[model samples]
Target: MTVKPGSIHALLGGNGSGKSTLIRILAGVERADAGQIDIGGAQFAAHSFNAGLAQKNEVHVVHQHSSTFPHLSVAENLSLGRGYEASIGGRILWPTVRERARRVLARFGIGASPDQLLSSLRPAMQTMVAIARALQDQEGSATGLLILDEPTATLSSAEVARLADALRRYAAAGQTIIVVTHRLDEVLDLADHVTVLRDGKVAGDLPREEVTHETLVQLIAGNSLPVSENRGQRRLAGRVLLQASGLCVGPLANMDITLGAGEVVGIAGLVGSGRTSLLRALFGLSRVSAGTMLFDGAAYGPADPADAVRHGIAYVPEDRLAEGTFPGLSVVRNVSMANLDRYWKIARLRTKAENRDAAAVADLVGLRPRRTDLAINQLSGGNQQKVVIGRWLLRKPRLLLLDEPTQGVDVGARADIHRLVRGAVSEGASAVVVSSDFSELAELCDRVVVLNRGRVIADVTADELTSDNLQQLAHMRIAA
Candidate 1:
């Protein structure tokens, strides 16, 4: 789809759908083997990818993860390129640079204490810095073709609204904008034009008025996804293997829950509704301000990930690549990473016996029977995710925590993961699965706890789960 001047356009798709690839091609990060791109009526024949970057079209692309030098202060990162422009004499006046950095960061709702290191802030705050740095031009106008790839991923609704307003204002001031997102609701409201990419190709290009949420859904998934069955009762509340009493993290608060052995519990919430924080805290990634988590009738407080893993609480984070598996690492290593204690002693030396153990678990997860040296990166995206889950499967935890377990995985592999989840249950292990796709929760979980702004809105059974119910719990106000 051609982006007109001063238009707020959107590229929408699921993971590996070429949305990132297309954006990278446009940003000159990667080259397109075929097709020519026309920018603002300029037909740039693609000889080399860098040719587009050198054109100086005032283009800036912010990817999903915030790219900030963690050791550097937020103010310092924002003012990195600005220093060349803000310099007075041959030398950069440090005090003047600090003064200008605060002004630039303030525009993005960020306070500039120019010396604060990036590591001191949260991931979302770091993302705002990347956005601020992208807009560090004079009159805040460097984003002639500002491309925000999942900018609202880690943001709250209010923050996303602020960014949507900012995009509108940018478009108002004659700046072209493109937002690459998976959320269809945001596109209907914030985007002026929408282009759907399926299988590394453009499937549909339509104006905002011409596209409905249903239309976009059908286009993206090819057809409507099947509705999950409203099956069996909450018959098996056998024993509370994992207990959360007054679990309060950032947005989650004052919650009481129990997961029985041989059962699955699902957590449903909007992207910003504190679902991620709830799981992270359970896994000991985030701080748990108030509440106690009891594992097998014992108080559990994980000092770190090692503590969590050692205690048999394996968590698969939302960003699978970041939290789940090492891509470049071999499949053998991916599986063995979790169960290293079984092999390693006082030394970090890996054993061949442990390698055989890893291969056995991989085969169990339907990851083909192969040599122990197969690189996980060389496998398909779905298989890579399987390797992640397979690795955790080797843990054989009593309680499993899965957040968006199949986000980027394909349809078939999704079923495979569900089977593996059931396999865990058969082994007398319970699980608490966090997923935005409510149907998935219905299919794989025995019960679901719907959260809104960190509070448990409703605790529902699998029989009561549906898209409408999930939407009501996630979006509309639940009756107090």
Candidate 2:
């Protein structure tokens, strides 16, 4: 496939669709056994990093996570590839480095000063700094390439717009850009051409004018995804299973929440708006400074997570990698970790019984490639999440809490997760979910509680809750 010069091309696909492999090949991190790479119409062996280095001045790559040293200044990050400014006597030249950083910042129209620490910048600004550093080595090259992988995965819509604007400036400056992302709106908004991959091959390649969101989704999933379900139609029994009033926990102030039996309630808010904090509090991961809570008609103050779990409360944390599942354990082990008591007999572990139960729950949660012995880290993000959430499902928990349930999940896996959640609710489990994706809340929740600055500003029921409604409510609260 030939990419147009000076165009912004979006590479999109579901997880495990070889998008990352292709990128690795392009970035010279992997050697291709077959086929050759042609950069600017010049053919090179796709066997090693040497080929990539031959065109080093013309190609730059910025990954999803910033590689910049947080404690260092922007100037230091920019001077990493290029030599640092040093005197003949081997003294560092801060002025020269800062001046160089200022020139690159000016070229990119970034407002950050060279001496400013990278960690002090906003996420969007830090991303811009990374991009600026990538371009610094190529200085005045008009026919260069900039590749960004999932640049806005963690950013809000507003921050995404800022990053898009910076990328557009690079494209306008005659740099060919390739962005690898799963976000459809971003592809439509920023890409001149879109390429979809499926099963290690290109499925669809279309110009910006030819692709719509529906078409892109179809290409990615290879089928029609289910329409958003009418959450209001689901009957939620009004038996309150969990209640909190005057709840205050680590930046959350006087928050009130009510969760009925078999109901899925979503907490919607921007980053740093106490969404995750509230989930942590509900799951007993955080200490409540002052609050009143009742669980199953009894006082609910968990001394720790163990107390919460013993009381039939299960939590799926936002950072799946760090807090949700143990990566080194097998899928069966991870699934059964929460219910080991069931498989323990006096002095010995019932391994066969544990595996049987783990396999059963794995099937129920629709865990793909259902191998009990595979390491949890070997599974995709969605499968790992299923293992995490599925652990609680086996326990017949009275309450479940999920934070960013599908943050980095692909469309197919996300659908599977939603089906699992609905199945759990059908079995009468009460759940509280926290997510930044408004559409996810609108699709899954019976009610959405919008938070702004640690306070509940609106409790929108399913019938009244649309993506636009949630966005407007949250934005207006912030504006107010």
Candidate 3:
């Protein structure tokens, strides 16, 4: 429970491990029942758990999703807490606020204009603004603590590196920082002290010197994880299930892909490299202006997702929360949404039969809580992803398209998902997986296809799939 001053501390845990709850208490978003918090020797009682009280104690939190107002300018967002320079009647001075914003932005190395709209900036810049706003008050510099929750979850690798560099600089300047992240690599790269939480209690605490990947995984899982040495087992190429020639979708040009039955193919690319676009094109979510596709010896161009689904094709979108799930729906309904026809009998919906089948698939997918009646939003991010992927299992899809399948998933659930996908592929279903994690692609795919500027650069077999190789090929510059 002791956090050293002027140090970077990382909090690691599995889903539902109370890491977020502990952070909320610190951030003044939640109240503690009994215990007191000692920040720089200043004791905060349970009753003093509000935003103003937390701010007075010099505690600030930057959430995973930025809370910056899209319509407001950067200067306005940065000056929200500490209002603008005002006259006797509280008349604000716009010039003073803009000047303050410029200084803050410059201090954080964020190359953005104070007058620029928050929505116009990229994700990384918006995160920078969030941090800059948190660090606005100079009066409590020595006593301040910055709490970041999963800051790099949606950032690209380069953006993460930049954020890490900024944090290191802040720590060097005697600022205390607490970061909650599931990415082990980020913890190792940016933290000086590490604490692992399990089931609402501290499982292990260690100095950065003593924490390793295997040790952390063991602490999080409460046991040693199985290390599979037999990786990338090559599958016998089956009959050609999908063939795309000269495909053209948004940001995708002349992309050619050949997928065989029972084979798993991985698509590797950087952000905006048309990875998601290609998957959407195949799933009929995006319009393919020019392309010829052959599916099962027939010309296959689906008019929409319904047509694609009817043709035995399933798509699990990249943004699971936004696109792949309905939060208001029950777990059973979400699980059976892709195949409602199977539950129809005599023009009446079979509710009991649907729940029964959904519960079975939920069990197979290792969904936590194992409750069919609860709303999908009640589950954790990992379990929600499981529901989205599990829904397709009942369809017995001929072609499965997955994008960033394990983005927010935990370590154990990630393994279960990989097993489920591979099991389906083994049962003669073709799969196309798009992932930014090259290691995931190497482990799950029989072949890896690298894309750069919407063009295929390399087609690598399972044996040749390595993180370094995939990274290099996906980032390699192609001549126009």
Candidate 4:
């Protein structure tokens, strides 16, 4: 694969399709087994390229997490990888650092003050700060090959547009960029060229004018149908399973939601829109200051996660690596961790029974390699998510609260997970899903509840559900 100078190139692929691995190789975070790299008429062996070489070649990277210290000022964050200006007496030159930060922020159109804490800015502005810091040279000019991984994943639609415009301006000024993103609309609007990876290989490479949304999806997913297809056939049982009335929690105002038996309800919102807060409140991770909840025709207010579990509620958090999985443990242990009491018999753990149940769940989730003994971290992001969801499926809870269940998974694995959720619901369970991906919510949910500043502005049924509609509703401002 080749990237031309002075062009915005998009690196497109499904999860586990070699996108992250390739990015790591280019950024010198990982060594490639065999390959050659060409940078500005210079050639180097891929294996010999290290962080030092990448820096010397003007290669810079900004990750999805932004890699910024929230508590630190914007000037401090900009001065991180690069050294600070120091006086002859070894005192740091604060004015010099702030001046340099101001120039870079202005050049990138980032609406952030140099002295302001990074956490004080909006999510989009924080991402722009990271990008500006990466692309800015010592001369305060954008003059390098910048690579960004999922930079807009957390931003709202309007914020994404602003960032895309900044990138376009940078590319026009002869700065080469490689953007790794899952959103196809971003590729169409921002990229000059596109390279797609599938199963660790280049599946397609096309010019921007030659690519369309359908063609890109076909390249990334191959022949497998999208999970969104066949949404018309799914039917929800006409019985309410869970209900919340005037629910008030952190960032959540008088919100009301109802989940039907064998139904999947989606919560759609921007950052801090109370999507995750709703899930946490239901899972008993957050205290509900006011309001009432009913589950299966009974008043339900779980004191804690253990209490929620005892009451037959399961929650899959948004950050799977941080909250869902035990990194070093085997798939079997991770799957059975939530329900260990089932294997405890007479003060002795029933290893065989645990393994048997885990294996069944692995099969149910279509876990690749079919090895329950493998470490949970060994699996790809998609499979790791599968293991996390499988853990909840093993217990067969009455109401499942999934926060971004398919956030970083591949198309195939996403379909598998959606099928698994639908199957569980078909067996009389109910689900409340929170996802930033509007398309996923439109496809997988029977009804979508749109939240803005913690209030339910719209509840859209499946017949009226579409990615565009969800986005429009979430961005709408309603008078209090």
Candidate 5:
């Protein structure tokens, strides 16, 4: 697929559909076996492209998890890529660096101070900082190609709009952009031209006017995906399995929520709205300083994750790469790690039993490659997520806490994950899912707890839940 100059080209595909590989090749992180690459009027054999060559050709990329230093100041992060302003005496000029950073931030409409820590900003602002840093040397010119991978995956709707506006301004100024994302709405809203990839080949290419959400999904999946049957009729009528009253954890203030047995409840809120905090608190990652919790008709408060696990609670964190999977461990080990006691026989680990159980869990989660011996890190984002979820599913936890379970996974993997979660819920497990994707909440949840500034603003029932309505509620500010 060819990207036109001065256009916002969207690269769409499922997991392992070669989108990441293609991006890596363009960014010079990976060598292509046999292909040709053309940037501007220059052509190079794909195998010959390297980091140095990509840099010389002015190709800049901001990955899904940006490589910005959180502990450092924005000025420092911006200066790291492009060298610092130094004097003849070899001393770094702090004032010059700050001024340049301010200029770049303003040019990109980023509302962040140069002296502020990169981590201090919200997810969207941090993303804008990364984008500004990527284009700092270009000075708003149209000379370089900017590639952003899954930039809006973790951002809220409002945050996504903010970033989309910035990108549109950049594209309007002739700065060419290629956005590789799993978000269909982003493609519909931001892309000038769309290219869908399937199994490492271009599936379809269409202009923005010719693209709809349905058409895009069809192209990405290589066929029309089955519409999820309406689950709104399934109301929360089961026994309350987990209930929290006046819950107070980090960023969570006086929040109250109830989860029914065999129910999937979604936590909806913008960044800093305590969506993840609720999950962490429930999973015993955070202490509830002031609250009353009831688990299965008993007063419950887990001291830690192990205690929670003993009480049949499982958590899947948002940043799967950093928090979920063990890098060098095999899928079997990862799956069995949560419940090692199940395989402990007379003080000796039962390897065969562990592998047997892990294989069953892998099949249940529909893990790709169907190999339990491969390192969990070797799998794609979706497959890695499946492994992580499968690991927890092996425990048959009573309460499942999922934070952005389908954040970066492809459409097919997402459906598979939803199916797995629903199947578990059907078998007497309850779930509390925290997600920025409103549509996901609408699809998988029987009820939604909407948070605003750490307060429970709305408890939307299934009949009233819709993606658009959830987005609105998340952005609303109710008077205390």
Candidate 6:
């Protein structure tokens, strides 16, 4: 198949459909055992980064989790590809450098100052900074190719619009843009051409205007998934497992909340809202400057994560690779991580017999066929997610914190995760889930609390929940 340049092309498919694999190959990070790359009408060697570099700085890729020094300032990050710091006879200056940084950021609608550290920004803000680098390098340069792999997975809809606009401008500026995303709506709006990959090869190809949503869904997912609406009403009056009064942090405040045993409260918000921070404050990752937390009818605000875990409060963070799964360890080890102290014998490692028992728990969580010997990376994406969730479920927390737990998961895996979460609650675990998906909040939550910017805007029960309602509440300007 022949591909063209300077067009907004998309690789559309479900989870494990080889979208990411293709991206890795194109980005010069993965070697395709057999195919050659042709950039700007010139065929390059099959497995060579030098060839990629030779093609006029051909490609730039942005991944799901960022790769940067977290402590570095935004200027430092943007300057990674485009130089801002100069030798200048061994002298350093700030204002002139940051002035250039601001000008570059405006090109992509990032709108952030240079002196701010990357650790201070949200994921979307960080992404904007990253995208600005591409723009910076492309100015008067020959960067003809760009690859985006799941770029909008963690972004809110509004941020997606901004990022999409930025990419569209880049394409209009005569660069080839290739996107890989499961978000069909984005594909419908932003793509000029679409390619569906099923197993390892192209399943179908269609021009953008020719592709309809239903037809695109048919190509990627084949058939729609079953929407399980069999959930019973939340009992609503079990013993209070967790209560937070006046929970105040950087962007979260006046968050008086109470969760009973078996209850699941979902906080829906946009990208910059304080849902994750709120969860962190409760889990002791973020400092709750002013709040009183109560667990099991007792006053409880732990000094740190260790104490929080000891008190049976678990958090599954938004950045799964960074905060959830241990990619370096075995499947048994990753799943049994949260409560490793349970299997330990006074500072010494557990015996092979105990390790095998951990593998049995892994099997219970549907990570079978490959056991303790298998590396955690060997499992498929869905199975990896199951292992991460199960690791915490095995801890039997009184309160679970789930932040965008289903972000990168496919529809089937999302349904399975929802089922698993509800199962955990049925077995008497309470949870607070933070999701950017309004549809998911309206579906799985017993009660929905919408946070806009930094404060609660609306609190609605499942009886009053709808996708439109949650979206409105999440986007509304609530009076401080």
Top TM-score hit: 1
Candidate 3 residue-wise lDDT, 1-480, digit = tens: 779999999998765678888988887888888788887777778656777778888898999877888889999999887678878899988898889889888877888999999999877778878988888776336567899988876676687888888888888888899998766767878899999998798999999999887677667656422324645467877899999999998767888999988899999976666899888988888999998999998999989999999889999999887899889999988887888788878999999989888888888898888998899999988889888888897788988999999987888878888888987887778899999777788778889999876788899984567655675566454554
* Candidate 1 lDDT tens digits, 1-480: 788888989998644568877777787778778677666555665546553452366668888766768998766787665553345557767677777777877665674477789888656566667877886773645345788888886666666776777677668877788888765667888988999887787889998779887777666656433556533234476777888899888777787778887788889876666787877887778888898899888998788878887778888877766767777777778788887777787786567867888778778878753555787777777787777777788778877888888887888888888888888887877888888676677677788888866688788864466545564455544332
RMSD of each: 5.4, 7.8, 8.0, 7.1, 7.5, 7.8
For candidate 4, which ten residues in a row score worst on lDDT? 224-233
**What RMSD value applies to candidate 2?**
7.8
lDDT of 4 by residue, 258-319 (tens): 88888888899766678998889888899999999998889999999999999889999999
Residue 78's C-alpha lDDT in candidate 6?
Answer: 77
Per-prediction TM-score: 0.74, 0.61, 0.61, 0.65, 0.63, 0.64
lDDT for residue 428 in candidate 1, whole number 0-100: 76
> For model 4, what is the C-alpha lDDT against the true structure?
0.84
lDDT of 2 at 148: 89
Candidate 3, which segments miss by more than 4 Å at Cα? Answer: 1-66, 69-228, 344-348, 475-480
Predicted candidate 3, C-alpha RMSD:
8.0
lDDT by residue for model 6 over 188-294, one digit each (tens)?
A: 88999999986566778999779887676566544423333754456584888888888888677667888878888999876556788888888889888887888
Q: How high is the CA lDDT of each candidate model? A: 0.75, 0.81, 0.83, 0.84, 0.85, 0.74
- TM-score of model number 2: 0.61
For candidate 3, the per-residue lDDT at 159 reads 79
- Which model, 1 or 4, shows the larger TM-score? 1
How far does residue 111 in candidate 3 sit from its true spot (Å)?
Answer: 12
How do these models rank on lDDT, best leading? 5, 4, 3, 2, 1, 6
